[model samples]
Target: MRENSFEHYYTQKPSSSLETREVTIRLKNGNVYRFISPSGAFSFGKVDKASRLLVEYAEVEENDRVLDLGCGYGLIGITIKKEHPDITLFMSDINERALKYAKINARDNNITAEMRQGHLYEPWQGYEFDVILCNPPMAAGKKVWQEIVNKAPSFLPSGGKLEIVAFHNKGGSRLEKTMKEVFGNVRTTIKSGGIRVYVSLKF
Candidate 1:
């Protein structure tokens, strides 16, 4: 299926006319976050179910270095930082507009994080993290997600983890398999509303 040009949130530069709106979300933990959403960012005004689920259930340890790959509008990373203040948070997105808003949201939320703009792991080359969380761009195509899985191991140390979320029937199963293939083990740590969060450990 060919996705419309406007729907390609994975693009480095979005062609959609830039428009801004403020979004406030109250998560299950009773924490509220504010974000500046712009046109062309994924799930612009609201956090999608899959991402919300990932934010609610993705595991992070204190003092761990974390990367939110493809972090749209900084939701996952920001929420994780709020929950685990001790963990160092890093966010990167291919979408320039999204990255810009991510920085603003971090500031609005009173969180400090290292922000970078690049495709996939490009901005973080030579850097390793204790955990990597992603709501992979399924709309971008299998190859993109495959690269995320295959290349993730090298960016993590032994016992480091990669956690990802997707709908079970809609590429989640395939992503699980790829994680297992690359990391040699995978586990479903949480599932809700047909979305599953898969965790893989680098061993």
Candidate 2:
């Protein structure tokens, strides 16, 4: 595995040495969560800025069926579930190490969520969600992110929303364009520090 390769984080069986660490993130909703992060997962040290931005801007409703696609260490889904306990949350990731930590985080937080290990949308076939949250794997390249934007509408019902966070210079514009083409409308909910949160409704 190349150093800094995002694909390494997507591996089903990671060969990297395990270095477990704890991370506490303060959310926009004024709630703080502590999670255990292993070395092989994405953002092992702390919650990444894009995920923070996504959690800040994305809307989660009570009783909403939510999917946190590419959930790394369960930050986005766990935080949302923490705030909206009535919602049904499903978290999926390709990385086994990330999924293990996500499970640990969910248990530690007393949050009930379905955690699955698979590529985007694979584990949720024939299922749909009222809202989908993602801090896309930008390091995995545009093809992966574009697939996420393209297939999102199929997994969402009418009026369902898909929210994503990406850096402005690094595929953000392209993702925004693809989102517009797919969802018919794309809105920038938040943009700061070179990162933008783009949201689209499946109307």
Candidate 3:
């Protein structure tokens, strides 16, 4: 199960031998960013399509407090911060190795963000965010992703947005339904390459 599933990227401590590589991503807006991705982290060679879609489509505003839930190597949050410097950015991930690389990537890219290592939203229990963005761990099973959807409202103020990305055929449809169930409203704002970005506004 460990070898087949995405458990390695979702664990607090990954068992894989440490290996690192530098990845560069150029966004649609022509912004180029670099990140240090380690072995056992998700999307090690480049930013995955789902995450890139989330980064591009999610609505961020000036001075908004943004939480990048399940951030892997700081792709979404770090990129958003670079794009909108005024927004306060927070990033968290269950995987310690991912968090470590996220921190390094943040520094390397000259982006400032608060990073925490914990499962789901535990690291930010009492905090509220204006926007929460995620590229969920689909292979980690339903419970993990369900927790993210079910508990997101508690950490968001009324009218706050929660955005997540996945392949429509590969668990994205279920995620859209779950978000609608939790938040009472949901919409797909972006779709390309079989990936979809689902957005919900908390009431």
161-199 per-residue lDDT for model 2 (tens digits): 999999989889999999999999999988899999999
Candidate 1 Cα errors over 4 Å, as ranges? 5-7
lDDT per residue for candidate 3 within 161-187, as digits (tens), equals 999989999888998999999899999
Residue 140 displacement in candidate 1 (angstroms)? 1.2
Specify the poorest-scoring 10-residue window by lDDT in model 1: 1-10
By TM-score, how accurate is candidate 3? 0.96
CA lDDT for candidate 2 = 0.89
lDDT of 1 by residue, 1-203 (tens): 23763256778898889988888767887888878888888887776799889888988998999999999789889988998999999999999989999998899899999999998999999999999999998877799999999999989999899999999898999999999898889999997989999999998
Full ranking by lDDT: 1, 3, 2
Instruction: Give lDDT per model, in order.
Output: 0.90, 0.89, 0.89
> How much RMSD separates candidate 2 from the native structure?
1.5
Candidate 3 least-lDDT 10 residues? 1-10
> Candidate 3's error at 196, in angstroms?
0.6
In Å, residue 130's CA in model 3 sits off its true spot by 0.5
TM-score for each candidate, following the candidate numbering = 0.96, 0.96, 0.96
